[model samples]
Target: MPTTASMTRRLAIALTSVVAIFWFVALGLGVYVMQDEFTEIFDSGVQETAERLLIIVANNEARDASGRPVEAAVLAPALNSQYLTYQVRDSNGMVLYADGAQEPFAVPLSAGFSQTATHRIYTAATTDGTLFVQVADALDHRSEALMEGGTALLLPLLLLIPGSIAAIIFVVRGTLSPVAQLRDEIHTKDGGNLAPIDESALPKELRAIARSVNSLLARLKSALEAEREFTSNSAHELRTPIAGALAQTQRLLSEVPPAFHQRTAQIERALLHLGRLAEKLLQMSRAEAGIGISDERADLLPVLMVVVQDLERSPLGASRLNVKVEDGTALERSVRADAFAIVLRNLIENALIHSPPQSPVDVHIDINGIRVTNDSALIEPDVLVNLTKRFTRGPTEASGSGLGLAIVKRLVEQMHGQLLIASPARGMTQGFEVEIRL
Candidate 1:
């Protein structure tokens, strides 16, 4: 079977994916904005350095030309490596002085900012425009700063995404827990259990569903009760008339002429079959009424013994039944005595009727459950599957109402037990078996 997708998992995954995508988009936008800001700040620094250097270089050159002493501190070379490199050039574009520059920048000397592939350049000049100072900031330094800023913003997401996923799953599972509970409660409703769901604890959205389900269950329970009552009453009303009719037919068989005896016997047989069918209907009604479950536990061994003994007294059961009880076996269970007896009677009677003449019906009892087996041709798989259905029978000439297994199956389920029907019973090659586990 294919696996089903969970609502909680699907919701969590969708939510997490959306959150991650938006987070990535926001991070990209943030990085873009930060890059622009960094460029502006670097440009300002480059322009400021060019203007300052132009003042100092122009003042020193004027002092040198006037033969006046220039302040050494103002013209001192930078002791540390600077991010900005500069070249001082005269109007003819000849280099006068340079700081942190291996070679003059390959660009025109003009005032204002310009950019080359490698650097951001800003130029400043004296009042006469006789000299110019061009400041160059390496492009790689700005790129490195932007990369570090982006990394700082991105690293937290590694932890945040997984943590968010975990939190999302947790919240999704919690939010859907009520739905799971409602499903379980609805699943418990059946013929044997039609109890209404408690709507008090449910959310507003699901309370309407619970109320609708409860209404349906109420109608169903009423209909089933009416059906069971009619079957039970009709069966009870039929038993006396059927028995009387069978007795009268048997008397008529004795009184009738030899030529009429065959027809009278046929009538007797028909009445007998009708009586058995009525009894089965009664049993089915009781099973449908959910009489198998009991609050009080009882020793089921005595009930089992009584049913087997009663069946043993019958001519068909006499000398054709074998009973085996495991040592130290205990049948203390919560199933009602009458219901358990009906189940046992049906299974044993079914086995006895279907088995060939002189074939022994074996009944095995243990702590776990009970098993009934009988010698017969192996039942077909398709036919075996439908054996517990009402009026369904196998390919057999034996007389049966076909409600025995159906009744037993109903009672077993009401008792919260499992009934398994199998061909080639256990280790035997040609037999049928009914095993019940309670």
Candidate 2:
């Protein structure tokens, strides 16, 4: 029952969250890879500076002891901006010279040339008897650089979050506009309206949805028509029994006849009316349900003949009735028809009730279709449209329940056939027409 907009918005949010997680993971990996390069560059710069300094000291003129051998003041300035520590130590551990004003710096020695697991330590022995070691605190330096770069990228994305959300809201609303219109249209629609949704403004992706909705609406329209007809039929069929009971009651009330006589007469008349109504309704129900109809192919003309003849023997069919089958018509050729007999019966019965007494009813059958036309004035054109609806009746005439024509329509449609009604307008030439495919 959730609206389309809500569903779309949720999906957008979920996708955004996934993208954010992926971005974070990628950022972490990028920083890790770049960290190694930063360390390598820093180490190479320090080593080159150390090697240059060693060459300078080994090439310095070896003046007499009184001349101050390579004064520490001269060397101190050269090592000022570099990450190196140097010391000249004798074989007996006596410090001959050093860079800073302290004892020889304690340089942790490893077994051989190996990169210490620690962030910053590199050592090498110079030919001039000087120990050159480079020391740098790269862990803290790298942490600061990563923080700065991450902030720059993260700040922009954080700002974009609101825009992304707003975009999702806008897109969701725009994408669902047709559905909203459909909702409002349906909201105002009443039982009398069953028109389909218009899809001219819909996007291609949403066209399928609109088509589905239209199909559902079409089905609802048919169902509503059937329901209205059913109600009309019930009311029409109930009238006779109600009128009979009222008449019997009036007679008993006017004259104080014997108790048994009045009571028995009223009960019998009521029971008769009820029985007839029930029988007709049952027949209509069975026919509409397509019960007992076989799938075997049968000639439509022969079926119509049998039903018309049977109706002629009944009281309703005593009027002038005729059956005509087009000889050698292509419609007589065997077709796929399982409910031929029921179809014929319903059409004939409907024509008999509608036509006036002594008026001829024409039953025509051909290869393509069968049509029943009565001599009576046709029901109005609009009324014909709803004739197939359950419980519907003609505007002026009300005899049997209106379910008969409805049953015929349902049966015909179920067989993938069609039903059509046509008659002349506003003249004595008007007559009921019913057509059904084989």
**What tens-digit string does per-residue lDDT give for candidate 2 at 198-223?**
77876787778778877887887687
- In angstroms, how far off is 132's CA in candidate 2? 3.9
List candidate 1 segments past 4 Å from native. 1-4, 67-82, 99-108, 198-215, 277-306, 318-339, 356-360, 376-396, 406-416, 421-431
What's model 2's lDDT at 386?
81
Clashes of each: 0, 8
Q: Which candidate should be chosen as best, given TM-score against the real structure?
A: 1
Model 2: weakest 10-residue lDDT segment is 109-118
Q: What's each prediction's TM-score?
A: 0.82, 0.50
**Candidate 1 local lDDT, 1-438, one digit each (tens):** 999989977887888788888889989999999999998998888888788888888878989999998774554453123577788899998887777775777888878988889988999988798999998899999999999998998888888878888998899889988999999999877765677899999999999999999999999889877877886688778998998899899999999999999999999889989899889989987887777877568899999999899988998898888999999999998778888999999999999999998789999999889999999998899999999999999989999899999999999988889999999899998799999999
